[model samples]
Structure formats: C-alpha cells, structure tokens
Target: MKLSILDQSPIPYGKTAEESLSASIELAKMADTLGYKRYWIAEHHDMSGLACPAPDIMLSRIGAETENIRIGAGAVLLLHYRPYNIAERYNMLAVLYPDRVDLGIGRAPGGSAEATIALSGNFLENVSKMPETLDELLSFFEGNFPKDHMYSAINPSPVPKVSPEPWLLGTSEKSGILAAEKGIPYAFGHFMSEQDGPEIVKRYHANTKSGKSLVAVSVICAETTKEAEELALSSQLWKIQQAKGEGKKGVPTVEEARAYNFSDEKKNDKIIAGNSGVVKQELEVLQEKYQTDEFMIVTITHSFEARRKSYELIAKAFGL
Candidate 1:
C-alpha cells in the first residue's frame, strides 16, 4: 500500500497556532524521511483548533523544508477564489518544487457562514459556477483555452517545467461524478464522510479517465490498542464538542476529555484507533472495500509526540 499524510495542524489545548504550524513542519519533514508518498496540508478558516487557513502559503514553506515528499493543499477551497489566482499560486509552488506539487481542489466553504461571505460574497453563486471555474482552472494548467477565450493570452506564471498534478477532493458521489467527468484524479474523504464510500469510488472509477483514486482516513496507531484509544480521547472529545457548537479553543487534553460529560451515545466510530497491527488490518479491509491501494492518513492528538509516533507506527506497519 502507498501511504500519504493529510495534516490539519491541530492546536493542542494550551499550545498556540504558531506551535501547531511548527509541529506541522516537523511532521512533514518526518513523513518525507519515512518514505510517505505525499504530505498535504488542509485549509480551514476561522477555526482555532485547525490552524491552517492558507494551505498554499504553508505548502511553499513545507516544500522548502521537505526533500522528496509531494506537498499540497489537500483541497484548496476553490469557491472563494478565482481560478486564475488559484492557478498562479500553485503554479509558483510547482516552479519551486518541480513535479512534487499537487493542486487538490474542493467546493466546500471551508469556514462558517460569516467567514464564507467574507471570503466570497455569494458562496451559493460560486457553487453554481463550479463547473466553469474548474474548467478554467484546468485550462490554466493545460494551456488549452480556445484562441478567442478572454483568458487565452494570459498565463498563470511563472510556469514550471511540469504542471502540478490536480486532484478533485470530495466526500460525496457528486464530487465523484465531477471528477470522473473532468478526467482528473479523485480523493475521497473517508474520514469525514457518512456516505457510501465504496459506491462513490466505484462510480468514479467506472467513468473516470485517470482511474486514480485515493481515500483519506482518520487513523491513530500506537504500541498497543489500549494506548491508541487513550490518545484518541482528546480528539474524539474535541470533535464531539465541536459538533455541539463548542471546542473553539483547540484540542483539549486527555484529562479534560476524561472529565467531560461525554457519553457513549456521543462516541465517534469514524476514528480508527488501535495498535499498528490492528490499524493495518482495518486499513486493508478498507482497501478491499474501496478497491484502492492508496490511503492518505490524518491523525490528531493532544500530544504532538504521540501524533508523530502514530504516523511513525503506521509507516512501519505498512513498510513504507
């Protein structure tokens, strides 16, 4: 199996955003040396726990620090920005990193309603025009705009020798259909979605020209299954609280999570927490269901060291 990473740069309870970002850099460098295929930073806005709002900016810095791993925005929320500007920013990264850059595009707001309006005046309108925007963005990369088109003469520069590989990220079948129609690579957010992932992936492959599919999953691995579950408590509680419109101060400590009034009814089954062997077995089950060989793992824990260790254990488990 080919392993990759999706970093949200989660801030621990008492840690600052700066510390979270620094940890992301350290993680990326570690992933590069561990033989992971890619390192993707997610973009989120106005969220204290998830520190990164501009993945493009972070990717520029990460590319400089990591030697070989492909660095990218797991999904640059394309709804808030113009295609040309998005193309230009990623193109610059491509110039700097050569073939090790990816441009993963998604249509979600990636923020709250107020933040969405602040970024783009009409988020709904932008959603309606996604097809056109995606077409224009792909054209900028392929340089295939018609001669009479308004953007034909313009270039998203300084263009690199190799264009960034573009991937469409989604959690639903609509995204799969769009990716298939566009003929680009597809990345399914299995960690976040409640939909039928195998069905979506199957449809994407049935019609997709690229035939490339990647499943991004939330996972936590440790020396023992009990240890992994204990480490995952903070993240699990944070998510539960966040769903109830709280937890803005970042991931809480395990002690805090343990003290919380969370009940079994609020437990999150999405996070796959276990020992390395158990985690590998669960991932293999997912692989069989999704019929894909690549998985992008995302893990968030209160302790940075534990988070790092989780990735390390997973890497060793997969022999990456």
Candidate 2:
C-alpha cells in the first residue's frame, strides 16, 4: 500500500500566510526524506489563514525543492476553473516532473462566495453546473469530450494533454458514484466529513470501475494517544476555520487549541491517533475491511518534531 501526504497550508493562529507556505515546504522536504509516497498541497482561496490559493504554483515551488517526491495539488477545485486551462496547467507540471505529478480534483468551491468571485471572476457562472462542469474539465484532460455529442461550447487541447493521474475527492456518496462512473480514482475526506473510514473505502472499492482506488485519512501520532489527540485538535482548528468558511478569530495563541472543540472521541479515532503499535492494528483492520490497495494519511500535527514523529511512527508501524 502507498501512503501520501496532504496539507492545506493551515494558518496557525497569529501566523502569516508566508509562514504557512514556508512550513509546508519544510514538511514536503521532510516527507520526501522519510519515504512518504507523495506530498500533495491543497488549494484554498481568500481564507484569512490558508496560503495555498494557487496550488499549481506552490506545487512547482515544492517540486523544485525536493527530489523523487511526487508533488501535486492535493486537489484543484475543478469547479472553479475551465478544464482546458486546468489540463494545460497540470500538463505543464507533468512535463516538468513526468510521472511524478498527480492531479487531485474536488467539487467543492474551496472557498465562499466573495472568495470564489474574487478568484474565479466571470467563471463564477460556471459554478451551478458542477457535474457538467467537471465533465467539461475532464474532457479537456482526456482530449475526448466529443463536442458533437453535446451542444455546449468547450475547446479542449489536443497537444500537451494532462497525463497525470486524477484523484476525485469528496465527502459524500455522490462523489463515489461520479468517480466510479468516470473511471477515476476516489478519495474520502475522513477528516472533514467525520464518516466511518472502512465503510467509505469499501463503497468506493466495490463500485470502482477501472482506475486505481485509494483512501486518504487524517491522523495525529505521538508516543501516547492523549498527546496525539491534543496535537490533532490544534492542527485541525487551523483547518476547520479555513474550511467551515468562518472568518479567523485572529491568530491562535499557543493555548487556544486547549479551549477549542472538535468532534467527539468517536470521531477522532478514525484518524487513528496513537502510538506505532496501536495505529498498525488500525491500519491492518482498515485495509482488510475496506479492501483497499492504497492509503494516504494527512497527519495533523504541525510541529516539526511532531510531524516527523507522525511519519516515522506510521512508517515503522507499517514496516515500510
């Protein structure tokens, strides 16, 4: 099983965007050295704390800084951009990195109205037709939309097509069907949706048509479960605000995470936050129950020391 890394450039309370990006770069380098399979950064626009509004650009910077590490946007919010443009942009990245690049796609706007409007401009009209819009985008990437079959107006590129693997990500069952029907790989966001990991993975794997199917989950690792949970909350708070569309409550003071509320314990355990021994049992169970071939982890601890521990423990646990 292959494991990957996903970071959305979470803005720690009181830190600047530059700080978040710099930290992501550092983490990317660490993951590469530690034998993590891939390092994918997410794209979020106009969030007070998120620094990855343009993941393509950031992935380029990250790819330049690391070697032999698969670097790509954890996802491009395909809803917000034209398919041809996305195809070309990611295609260029693929050219630079060859098979080392991947293109993760999600249906979410990756932001709210004001931010979407600001970032997408006239393209905002394209939002209402999400499934169709995604179809158009994929048409460009696949170079086979067959405009004659439809009355819509879309021009796809025949040259420099994006050959990178496309990973469809979502929090709902509908996304599973969409990914399966389209013959694309799918990833369940267990971190955001608070769903059962084994069930989601099983559903996707059972229904997947032809592409490689994978599951990505979130976790915080430490010598003990308590420390993992504590660090995870701190890491997730920075993410929740960015994702839940709330304005920042200002930079987080060091102690604020202690006071914040995330989901209950039943919810947190899916991330499998614990020591090496405990997490291994969890992963083996997940693999068997989910019948999965590939698994990715979004480790939530952001401290340099904690992040390293998270990767090391998982690798050791998996005997990788």
lDDT of 1: 0.94
lDDT of 1 by residue, 1-320 (tens): 99999999999989999999999999999999999999999999998699999999999899999899999888899999999999999999999999999999999998899999999999999999999999999999999999998889999999999999999999999999999999999999999999999999999999966679999999999999999998889988999878878888889998997787766546778899999999999999999999999999999999999999999999999888
Candidate 1 Cα deviation (angstroms), residue 219 = 0.4
TM-score of each: 0.98, 0.84
The TM-score of candidate 2 is 0.84
lDDT (Cα atoms) of all candidates against the true structure: 0.94, 0.72
lDDT of 1 at 90: 94
Residues forming the 10-long window of minimal summed lDDT in candidate 2: 151-160
Candidate 1, residue 112: Cα displacement in angstroms equals 1.0
Error of 1 at 9 (Å): 0.8
Model 2 residue runs over 4 Å out of place are 121-128, 145-162, 195-200, 236-254, 259-270
